[model samples]
Structures are given as C-alpha cells and as structure tokens.
Target: MKIARLSSADIHWCEDGDPQGVPVVFANSLGTDLRLWDKVIELMPKQGLRLIRFDKRGHGLSSCPPGPYSMEDLVEDTRELLKVAGVHSCIFVGLSIGGMIGQLLASRQPSLVQGLVLSNTGAKMGEAAMWQERISSIRAGGIDALADAILERWFSGKFRQSDECLAWRHMLTRTPVEGYIGCCEAIAGTDLTASTSKLDLSVIGIGGADDLASPPELVRNTAALVAGSRYVEIAAAGHLPCVEQPHQFAGHLMTFFKEDLHVTKV
Candidate 1:
C-alpha cells in the first residue's frame, strides 16, 4: 500500500504494476477499502497492465475528515489520486457507491477518463425519499443500524449462512458511523441522469442478477440511459459480484476490456 494526501488527510491505495497495460483505477464501495477488489484482482491477467485501487477519503486506512462530503469532493479526491500516481487518462472502474462517483467524475472531467465500468450502481440511485430517510437514520442512530441491512443486501442469504466469505461482510461491520453517514450524504446527492446521456467515452455496465443492493434491472436501466453502453448481469451473484463469483466476474471484465473493446492492454 502507498499513501498520499488528497487534501488534509492521507489517502491510501494499492497498485499492481503493469507499465505496458492500460492504466485502470478501481474504487471500492462506501465502507470498504482497496482490499474490496482483492478477489477480482486475483483473477485478472497482469500482462503488463497497471491496476490501481484506493480507499476513499472516509474508508479503510484513509482519514475520516469532517461530515457531509459531497460527490464532487469525492470526484476531486479521485482526480488527485490519479494525478499523483502520474496517470494520464485511464479506465475508471467503480462498484456500488463507487460507481456513482465514477459517473460524476467521468462527466465532470471527461479528459481524465478513457473508459468506464460501472457495477452494482444506478444513475438515479434510490428514490430521494428513501435516501433522505436513510441519511436521517444513519446520522441519528449510526452505521450499526444499517450494517446488517447492508450486509444482507450485498450477499445472498446462502452466502451469509455459509462461511463462503466472512471477511467481506466483516469489513462492512467495521465501518465507522461518521464515515458511513458522510458517504450516505454523497450517495443521497448523487444523480447522473443528465450526465449519462452526454458521456463520450467507452462504457461497460454490469450488475448481479440477484443484487438487492442495486438490482440488475436498475443497472440495465442505467445502461439504457447511456446511449450505446453494453450491459451484463452475472447470474447467481449479489451486489459484490467480483467476490461472490471471481472467475465469472473476471471473465466478464476481461472480455469487456480486452475483447469487446479495443482497450489494448499494451
């Protein structure tokens, strides 16, 4: 792991060196760190590719600044991360709330992005009413009130019952309440309906068939709004597709980047 400050706090990330491959930045969900991508990263063919993963401002080993960080702030934070890493334009891959950040960032600064991969997220996200209620609940009660609910949404009941992946759910349990609420604010204010219509970049949208967190239907609708974006739904997976089914996720990911698109991993 490497560390750099985006603003007042130090941001942390892990890098897989592949100078010849396309530079790809992967952002984790709201509460998790760069480690969230471990399973998926394990499957990707390095083949001289550069891979980057980062803990958002409030997650992982990163510092949790004050409350109510905006989506734009998150975008800028990512921009700085890329700049510091000497990345020019790169593919932006995001999951869950991370996907929301990717949408806004790609829209706000198209020059900084070469391609986009959005998973387990929607353009409009939840209804404004529901997000408002969630924000209130999180702020008032804490992340504990939402941890089990989120864990449940992210994985299947069978997964929870089995010890297939306890670490993933455990990470959610370890999230700080303040950080969760701050990210909740970011999610609440997020809406990329207009941005999706105008993006002029390569995009591959994906979601899990059984994702309660962000359904495939929602992801399909999001892809529909993106003009010509292709969509995929991993069967028998949940919100965290990469973890639930790593090989399948990698197959979809590699096909999207290398075969379908001319992403020249050189």
Candidate 2:
C-alpha cells in the first residue's frame, strides 16, 4: 500500500499506468475511498497516463483525526499527497467534496493544476444548518442512520434495487462516524463560488440527471463560473455517475483530455 505521511495525516494513495505519462489525479467524494474511481479507471486507456487516487484524511484506511475538519485541511492534504507522489502538474478529477477541494487548490496553487473535472458537486454544497442537522443525527445514531437516504441520493431507484447497491450501502454505513462528521463540517463551512469563478483553467462539469444531492442545474451553474467551461448531464444516473454510468463518464473524461488539454495518448 502507498501512503503519504503528511504533517496532519497519513493519506492512503495508489497510482496506475506509467509514472512518466501525463498525470491525472482523482479525489473521492465523502464517505468513499480511492476505490470510488475503480470502475472509471478500468475503462480508461491502458497507456500514456498516470492515474492517481487517494483516500481523504479520515476515510478509507487513513487515520481519523477529529471532528469538524476544515476545507483548507482537505486541500492541504491533497496538495501534499501530490507532491509526495511526484506530480508536478496534472488534470484533477473531483467528485462532491472532492470537487470543492479541487476548486480551492486550483485557486490557491494555480500552477499545480492544468485542467479540472467537477462531477456532481457545487460551489456551496448545502446550508450549514442542514449539515449540522445531519451531523447531529449521525452523532446520535451513527452513519447507518442516514445510509438509506444517502444511498437514495447516490444512485437511481433502479440501481438501488440491484445487489451492487448493497455494497455501496455497506461502504456508507461502514464509514467512521468521526470521519464522516468531520467531512460534513468541512462541507458545511465551504463556499467556493468566488474562488471558482476566478479560475481560468480548462474545466468540465458533469452532473447526473437523477442527482438529488447536487442537481444538474447546480452543477451546470458551477461550471458556468469558469469562462470557457463545458457541462454534460448523464441520464439514468444520480450523484455518483462514475459508479452508475462509468462508460459514459469515462468517455467525457477522455474527450476533455484530448480536446481541451491536448492530451494525445490518454
């Protein structure tokens, strides 16, 4: 297992494809680990790319620090992880809270990110009060309490009936309470509207037609913040389109790499 021992936390990370190939770093959504990108990675071209993925501070095998983490903390952890992994510049693909991290990181350290893909996320995820309420509920009853509702938002009704949905439910309910709450607090405190609007890099915003967490309009609006960003919505999918519709999602990513970033091999 690959690990980056950052000052604040030990981040679990993994890389695929050539080390010298063009870099593409992926950041996971809340309550998920690096494996969140497994299906998408499998569909990607086998050559000429270095795909990096990591578990955020408190999720997956990473150590849980404490509750109420900040967005700055998450961004710094990712920054350090990239440095340790020897990535100088790369396209960043972020989902949900991961997308928020990509926005802040690109804003603060523009030289580090060359392109961005924001998937099923918003500049401001939700109101602080709503996050606080969810946090309280989790604290009182653990992550299992909200697993059903969260899964509903994550996948469409047809997917919810499939056996694969049970595995996602397990991933959700198994997330550490403190870790989940910490991310919730971080999401609650972040608002990337102004920062994201100032970004000049190439960007693509992807949304799921069935997404209830961050609707298609919200994702499109966030993408519109960038001067020349593009937006696409996937049908029959929800918040985690990479999981629900990997083939279509991967196609969009490959197109962005080739057309916008001018990546020929990937």
Candidate 3:
C-alpha cells in the first residue's frame, strides 16, 4: 500500500510495469477507488508502460478532507501525487469525474500530460441543481438509497444482472458520504468548456453506448473541443466502459499510445 502525503490529503497509489517504460496514469470515477482500473490494467501490455493508479482525495483509501472541495483541489492532489511518484510526464486515462480532472489539469499544465484518454466524461457534467438534488438524496437516505439508480446508469442491463454488479454496488455504498458529496459539489461548480476547447494536446474520448450519464454524444462533443481529438463509442457498455468492456477500452488506449502519442517501449 503506497501513500503520498500531499498538502491536503494522503493519497493511496500503486505502480506497476517497467520503471523505465512510458508513463500512463489512471484516475478513477466518483464513488470508486484505484481498483476501478484493475480489469483494464490487466488487459494492457505490460512490457513498455509504467502504470500509475491513485485514489482521489475523497475516494478509495485516500484520506477524505472537509466537504465541498473544488475542482482545483482535486487537480492539485493529482499534481502532487505525480510529483511524489517522480512522473514528469504521462498519458492520463480518466473516467467520469476523473476525466473532468484530466481536462482541467491538461489545460492548466499541458507539459505534464502528453496525451489523454477521457472515458465516459465531459467538460461540464450535470447542472448544479441536478447534482444538488442528488446530493440531497444521498444525504437524506445514504448512498444505498441511490445505489440501484446509480448502478443502472453505470452498467448495461445484462451486466447489472451479473454478480460482478453487486460488487460495484458495495463499492459505491461503502464510499464515505462526505467524500462523495464533496466530489458532487466539485462537479456541480465545474464548467470547463472554454478551457477544454483551447487545449492543444492529443486527446481521445471513449463512451459507453448504453451510458445514461455522460452519454455518447456528450463524450463526442467534449472530444471535439480539441482541434484534432478523436472519439470512440463502445457497444453494450454504460458509464464505466473500463469495467464493462475492458478489452475494447484497453485496445483503444494501446492504439492512442502508439499512434497518437508515438509512445514506444524504451
């Protein structure tokens, strides 16, 4: 269990693959931890990449600070984690809220991110009112009250019937309430359309065809913000394609690394 003590929190992280290989950093969605990428990582080529996965301040094993954190706070946590891990540059793969963090981070510090794989996310998520309503629901009844609804948005109907879906339910409901709500507040206040449109970095957006949240059109539109970005939609998957369709997801990542970023084994 590796941990980086940043100014505001203790981030839990893990490293894999060749130390000298090209760097790839993964940021997970809200209500999830570093384990969110476990299946995707297993499918990735192990020879030529340095894989870094970390829990955000309010999620996973990382310490949860006070409520109502900002997007800037999340980005700073990622920046400090990378600095502590000795990663000067990397291809960042982010899902859901993680993708928002990726967008803002790339805009603010382009040199640190060589490329981005934005999965099931957008520059602007739902409206503040909607998020606030969801926040109120969670606060009133706890995550369990909304777990079924959230899971429906997260997975395809077929996947939801499987036992694997139960595990995700557990993961979601187990998330600290304050942490989840804090991220909700961050998402509520963030609108990165202008900043994302100005990014000159290489980017590819992936979305689940069955996704209810951050639908394919939304992901495609966000990708279009960058002049030369690309977009792909995975069939039979929902919000978390990395979980529901990891092989397809990893294939996209490998393609982007070799073709777009020109990343090759060192």
Candidate 4:
C-alpha cells in the first residue's frame, strides 16, 4: 500500500510484481477503487512487470476535496502521482472514468505513456443534464439509492443475481457520496474526442458484449478515432469485464502488451 500526497489530493495506491520490471499503471472506474482490478491482476502474467493501481480522488482511500471536479484536475493528479513514484514511462490501463484519464494523460504527457488501453469507457459519457440528475439523486438519498441500477448496468442479469454481485454492490454503495458526485461532474464536462483522436501511441479498446453503460459501438467509435487502434469485445460480460471475466480480460490486455507494445522492447 502507498499514498501519493499531491498538492491537490492524496491518492491511495498499491503495487505488485517487480519494481524494476515493465511498469503498468491502472486507474479504476468511477464508483469502485483500486480493488476493482484485483481479479485481473491475479490472472495477469506476473514476471517482469510492475503493476500499479491507484484510487482516484474521491474514491477508495483517496481524499475527497469537494464537489464539481474537472477532468484536467483528475489528469493532473495522475501525472503528479506518477512523477512522485519515480515512474518514467508505463503502459496505462484505465476502465470507464479511468480510461478517460488515460486519454488525457497520453495526450498531455506522451513521453510517459508507452501504450494505452481504454476499457468499458467512452470519450464522452452522457450529457450535462443526465450527470446533474445523478448528482442530485446522490445528494438527496446517497449512493445506496443508485447501487441497484448501477449494478445492472455494470453486470449482466444472471451475474446480478449471483453472490459476486453482492460484493460489487457493497463496493458501489460504500463509495463516498462527495467523491461520486465530483466524478459525475467531471464526466459530465469531459469530451476527449479531440485529444483521443490525435494520439499516436499503441492503443486498444475493449468492451463487454453486454455492457450497457458504454456499448460496443460507442467503444468501437472511440477506438476508430485513433489511427491504428484495435478493438475487442468479451462475451457475456458487462461494463466491468475485468471483474466478471478476469482471465479473458487479462488475455486481451496481455495480447496488446506483448504484440503491440512489445514488452521485450520496453
């Protein structure tokens, strides 16, 4: 466990595998924290890789400054953390909001990003009104009220009925309300189309077959924005494929890293 204490916020993070090995940084989704990647990390090839996972501001053990955060702020926080941790370059893997962060990071600090993976996310999420409504609902009743609907969008119906869903629901509901709302505000304002389109790095976009939050078409379109990006869809999974299908998810990532990024070259 580690904490990157930035001027803006304190970021809680965890790392595994060799410190001197290939570096891979992971940013989680909106509601979940670093733990969201536990299953995927367990199944990933562990030799010669330094895996770093961080809880975004307002999620997990990271500090919640206030409401109405900006996409730039989130991006800056990640930049600061990487600098503080002595990471010169890495293969950045981001899910949902985390994916959005990667788009920004690769554009802003190209030298630091060797390859990019955008999973279960879009360049632009929803309209301002929709995010405002979600924020209002959270303020009125807390995140618990949105857990059921969120889980439905996150996992398939059959998975929703299983015990595994219970843990995810708990994670969603336990998220700090301020953090959730702040990220909602950020997502509402972010439109990464311009930045993502201009990126020239090795990139791959992964979507779940059953994902409703960011459908396959949307994820594919985002991938299309980049010149040579690849796309893949995992079967029977929802928004968080890394959770419901860890091995499959990890396989897609490994293929990208080994083939595209050429881990040996790094």
Please provide, for model 2 over 20-118, each residue's C-alpha lDDT reduced to its tens digit, 9 standing for 90 to 100. 889999999999988899999999887989999999988998988886799999999999999998888989999999999999999999999999999
lDDT of 1 by residue, 120-170 (tens): 888877876787788788778776678778878888777777775567767
Model 3 per-residue lDDT tens digits across residues 1-266: 99999999999999888788888999999999999999988887778899999999878899999978999999999999999999999899999999999999999899999999889999999999999999999999999999999999999999999999999999999999999999999999999999999999999999999999899999999999999999999999999999999899989999889899988673
Please give the TM-score that candidate 4 achieves against the real structure.
Answer: 0.98
For residue 51, model 2's alpha carbon misses the true position, in angstroms, by 0.4
Worst 10 residues of 3 by lDDT: 257-266
TM-score per model over all chains: 0.94, 0.99, 0.99, 0.98
Candidate 1 residue pairs in clash (backbone atoms < 3 Å): 18-49, 21-48
Q: Superposing all C-alpha atoms, what RMSD in Å does each candidate have to the true structure?
A: 1.6, 0.6, 0.8, 1.1
| Distance from true location, Cα of 50 in model 1, Å | 0.4
Error of 1 at 144 (Å): 2.4
Q: TM-score winner between 1 and 4, please give it.
A: 4
Per-model lDDT: 0.82, 0.94, 0.94, 0.92
What are the runs in model 3 whose C-alpha is more than 4 Å off? none
Which pairs in model 3 have colliding backbones? Answer: none
> What is candidate 4's lDDT per residue for 81-110, written digit by digit as tens?
999989999999999999999999999999
Task: Please say which candidate is ahead in lDDT: 1 or 2.
Answer: 2
Enumerate residue pairs that collide in model 2.
none
In model 1, where do residues sit more than 4 Å from their true spots?
A: none
